[model samples]
Target: MVLYTLAPGIRLSFNEIYTSSWEKGDSSIFGERMLIVNFCIHGRCDVSLAKNRYAIVKENQVCISTVMPTKDFYYPRSLYEGIQLYLDLDILHDENGQDFLSALGISLEQIVEIFCEKDGLYLHQMNDTLRTLVKDAWDGKDDIEIGTLRYLAVRLLHEIMSMPAESETETYFTRSQIAMVKEAETLILSDLTTRITAKELADRFGVSESSFKFYVKGILGDSYLNYFRKKRMEKAAELLETTNLKVIEIASAVGYENQGKFAKVFADTYGVSPLEFRRLSK
Candidate 1:
């Protein structure tokens, strides 16, 4: 993939139909101080950050990230392409920008959570109005026309943020609990290669092991290790679909040293082998 950095603070990086293969086992620390807003225009892609993983960011889906020192990769490899909009906090606070942020119920902390949390995909219906706005900007013939599209893009982001937060009942974790759980998840994902025990995690979070276990189980209805394993497996699934990496390599990247055990667990969780799942996705 071709990488470019537009204007230092506020810029748009566009890549059209860029095709490339991601290494089987690769991870990097994403630098900080920028907001990444990606739009999937032509084909599908997946990204794994921390412990969360997303698949097939279909056309029109927007994925935003603010955290740094993380890893991301793509899968399915179908002409893999998209646009990355990077904005600094200052640009996001312009008069018009302030209005947009208010509309989305966005706070500085919430923006950080959006990127650091596992659920990064935000789905919105592409109605006529939205479609027309996109068409005018992306299909426009010149720079001046394309610049006008930025306003519409801001409005679209507002519309997305304005949508009610997903119902709490729909998620096993309550809103407050989710924040805490997400913080814990970030820790787990940051170093998947190491062995982490529940007691150690509990101490780090300043709670007794029993209380920590209770908190995790109450929200996710599962033990800490189980939840951690699920997150790793989810990351593996994304890699399997997006990269040409072998199953063993993917397994190791997500903290599994035993490929056989990893395969069995993955198949049981997904109802199909990783190879089979990747083939079907393609």
Candidate 2:
């Protein structure tokens, strides 16, 4: 993570090739009163929000939030890249920060009025223009010219502030629900040789079938079978690349007793047969 001070009390951060192992969220170190915008460009992130609820920030999604003191936030995918814009009102309302914001036709009070409420959070899907600006932010991470960066930050901020309110807030699931989904994933994927149905997995975990599917899709961004199949194939690919195991043995290791089906799925995912992939690897 690289931090650039665009303006007093206004900073932008670029995260490149990062992975998180913690599940805690506390922003007190930054300041007491601040607005945060998170641009998830490549991977998904779990955002712990107020009232034991949480939000998921997937690729190409933006989270504009003022509610802090969230807990248990983590990155699902290992490699994550994104940009964070921080506006600490404590300093932004100061003489210099105030003067800077005023010069850009921005009133600090208005932003607070619109985005700050009890547990305020707004999630938006980034379109082409917004995505472009975020890309510019990424491209300018090493830029010595701070003026271009300042413009990019303010422009992205303005774009987010101008978007309409959405009802996706209701889609947020509870922390326990996320926990249940994760535990299910761990249990089912713990042993590649053990086969389990979606219904069985959900019932084993004490969640209803519908709620189970909802949480799986919400957290993993895919249905249970798709997510499991992809995970299996990932393990298969790693084994193929690293081990002396034959293709059939690798299939059983990833829970595929039928070599034909395993070959088909592997081919569909990687655009090559397992043997071809191994031969190409050599």
Candidate 3:
């Protein structure tokens, strides 16, 4: 795949047709609020979002995600090819911010509703006509002029802004609770070798132990113990696949004192023993 800056605050990433599926870690973290449109011109892929949400984009389909901090990955299957258009809000703000919104038939209230008021990922599927237009633009991305690309982006976004807001799940966590949950995730994952208990996490975050657990469950949709176990398993798997450490050492690295228990959990999680997994990965 290749990424090209078609214009300021606008970029296109595409790849030549390939028989094998596209698979890689996409750790591109956007700093500010931005609009992104993804066009699956020639393949199907699964996108992973935080908090256990996922979106699947298929051939000839388009998906839009509004302003938010994003950390995601795409796993494509088959002749995987696609283009992503990034619209930076700062550049689009212009001299008078209202002018840009007016030109696109979007209002400040609507922007807030779709981008800020919402929780989790704000993604919506485009109608078929808009989908075709997006696909056409992406298919010709390599040859399209900058002006034409900008025009296409605006047109696509106008339609996207007009779509109905996605229904939101009832979130029980307040803003502070949500922030604490994020902090908790960082702290837990920060040290893999230490088993940090829920009480310890609550103490560190300065929240009551029960309240901390409640907020974490609300945000992650999993209990603290379950979530902690999952993270440790993920670390163990990464170590097994990427390092030359022995199984016992790997077990110790991820907070498991007993190698036998570690092997059993690894097998349950990955359907293979750690040694076999290492061999297969290689």
Q: Which candidate is the best by TM-score?
A: 2
Query: What's each prediction's TM-score?
Result: 0.40, 0.88, 0.50
| Angstrom error at residue 48, model 3 | 21
Question: What would the per-residue lDDT of candidate 3 be over residues 1-282, giving only the tens digit for each residue?
Answer: 666665454565665555322433343524365666676666555454445444455566565555342333333222456667665656556534544435556453455457446553444455786777777876676687766765776676677666667733334334456557767777767788888889998898888999888877655656898777877887888888889999999999888999999899889888999999999989
Worst 10-residue lDDT window for candidate 3 reads 69-78
RMSD value for candidate 3: 9.7
Give the alpha carbon lDDT tens digit for every residue of 117-221 in model 2: 545676777878899988877876676467877777768867766666552454777778888887887787789888888789778878788889988888878
Judge candidate 3 at residue 11 and give its lDDT.
Answer: 64
Q: Model 2: runs farther than 4 Å from truth? A: 17-20, 23-29, 96-99, 139-145, 167-170
TM for candidate 3 is 0.50
Judge candidate 1 against the unseen true structure and give its global Cα lDDT, from 0 to 1.
0.57
After TM-score superposition, the amount by which residue 272's alpha carbon in candidate 1 deviates from its true location, in angstroms, is 35
Q: Which ten-residue region of model 1 has the weakest summed lDDT?
A: 20-29
Question: Which prediction has the highest lDDT against the true structure?
Answer: 2
**What lDDT score goes with residue 48 in model 3?**
45
